[model samples]
Target: MKIRKIAFLITFLFLWRGVMAQENSSSLAFSAYTDVYYSYFSNEMEPNALQPFTTVSPRSERFGLNVAQIGLAYDSQFVRANLILHWGDIAKATWSEEYNNVQEANLGFKLANGWWIDAGFFATHIGTESFLPKNDFLSSTAVATYNEPFYQAGAKLTYEGSDDFYTEFWVLNGYNRFLDNNNAKSIGVLFSYNFSENTSLTYTNLLGTESAEGSAVKQYRIYQNLYLNTVLTERLILIVGGDVGTQSNSKLPNMEETAIMYNALTTLRYLFTDKWSVTGRAEVFNDRHGFISGLIPTQNSGMQGLELWGLTLGIEYKPDPNSYIRGEARFLDLDDNAALFSGSYSRHKRWELMVTMGYQLDRVFGF
Candidate 1:
């Protein structure tokens, strides 16, 4: 009798465990990825030296870790949540002075008629390049660095309508501020239209006040972005993006004029084989008021507008679905008399070469 009772108890527990596992299978998931790279700059900077307007490869001529992220997500019929942890230079640049390493922490719930609302820190919807290098076309564009917002802490309401249209409305802290920089809040909206499986267009706009509390000057920033993606052939794709922005009450002391900046870029990507591809990009960025680039006028140079143009060519080789190797060469040309490119003296051109390796692990422990 004792042996039979023990057997029955063990069998009951095993069945219960199986039931629980089945129930959780559809509700939880895990994912992670790592990106490491070595980069060399032709400017002759030391390893680990600071490179202006560059984030992923800030330190030239060195091996560096770009980003490593781990994420866990939960989804159900009515509710969903995601938590992502980040490490390496991507985190440092994304957060800046903020100490938190959380890349995304959001909670959402489904509403009626294909609507959903989410609240928390989320990646910005304004840029074509993602914080993760693997998701980007080449390394990154200069426009992505100087002109785009990295992340926003906010709440958003999204609607997925018929006919391949989608929209989002957002309310949030000041631009790029994980924590509120001031009492003022920002507002933004995004619209996307998918013409077909091969083509799409998106527009994003944001208006916000970034001034500190009790400051004499009230600074406001208005930003706009437009992006287009098209597949010209089964193996060829193209992307074009542009940005226009202005900030009132420039931080350049006693300057009350609106500072205007604009950037535009186009990228072409072609796949030669299932595992090999090439990408090229051309970009132009202009900081008309010396406000956007934040390069203060030196006594010799005075306060002059700054203009930059860049060209990038990269090749990628994927060994498997989960890993890849990429090599890229970038050339940058600046306006004459702009010393921002080379620290020692004013130069018109610069070059960078980089190689990256990436791997991803998804659903490692769950269905």
Candidate 2:
């Protein structure tokens, strides 16, 4: 099975290369990259240690076709269509066989009235890439966020008639469940207003989900985002955002007493020169599930504990528009004198570090 899959991928790659090599008037395109990384852990424990205890090795490498974006685009009036295929995370093994895992094809049509309609498994239209968190390079070491990443398999519409206001709505599969009838359904909405070039505000909401256990619980989220461009001249930009949400019957056990998760983050980006820039970010998470708040477990199936905070520090390097790299280090303390979420006997501390690199090529071929 592995050999057949690899052979098929190679054949597709070569055929794509030949097609791009053609001197025709088509807008099809492709690009790919590799991520090589190493990470270390402090106070890490074995898999059976307890809640928040996970295994970490000295070195691990993940490789795959990073991004293969293809589309039919025309630049004349108000008409465009894009079909993007992100060859993502082929080595995860467990999640590689998902029906929605293969390709993300988006069909978009823009109208002259500033209204657009898009249907496909496209990149999420939510706040920050954090909404569709990329954990390949920087896994969720400590803190947990309310939003999950890249919700496809639905239709989204956006309206941008005015310079100050824009709104987007999407009806999609709640999480990444693909098109399974057993999975929950979800609706996502985004609203943003730009008072000026230097300032803006935005909000996002995600709701309606049913667990595989037939739990009719729902999740809701709200975010407030602020951006200031003139903190000290036009070279510095400051971003501050907060997200709060309710997750009933979370995938995490012993913390599912209708747990609530909220996060606060602040970042400062300074452009020392036109080609070089620096960014510093600090984040904190407050997770109060059940036991940490001193609430007794309702039954043997109820939650038993709590987690207070997690921190992240990262720096990014962007030499040009086509490439960027970021390194992130984070530490999480899962101490509340609580029992293991898995009904185990022990609990441990965890720390994680990760790095990521991304590049975009506009037109990689010469016709």
For model 2, residues 265-364, the per-residue Cα lDDT tens digits are 6666677776566665566555555311233232344554445455666666667865666666765545455333222322333455656565555553
lDDT of 1 at 165: 94
Error of 1 at 195 (Å): 0.4
Model 1 lDDT, residue 293, Cα: 65
True-structure RMSD for candidate 1: 5.7
lDDT of each: 0.80, 0.50
> Positional deviation of 24 in candidate 1, in angstroms?
10
lDDT of 2: 0.50
TM-score of each: 0.87, 0.64
Q: Write the per-residue lDDT of candidate 1 for residues 258-360, one digit (tens) a residue.
A: 8878888899999999899999999998875765566634336766666788999999999998898999988887776665555453355688888989998
Q: TM-score of predicted model 1?
A: 0.87
- Predicted structure with the largest lDDT when compared to the true one: 1
Model 1: residue 130 alpha-carbon error in angstroms: 1.6
Q: Number of backbone collisions per candidate, in order?
A: 0, 6
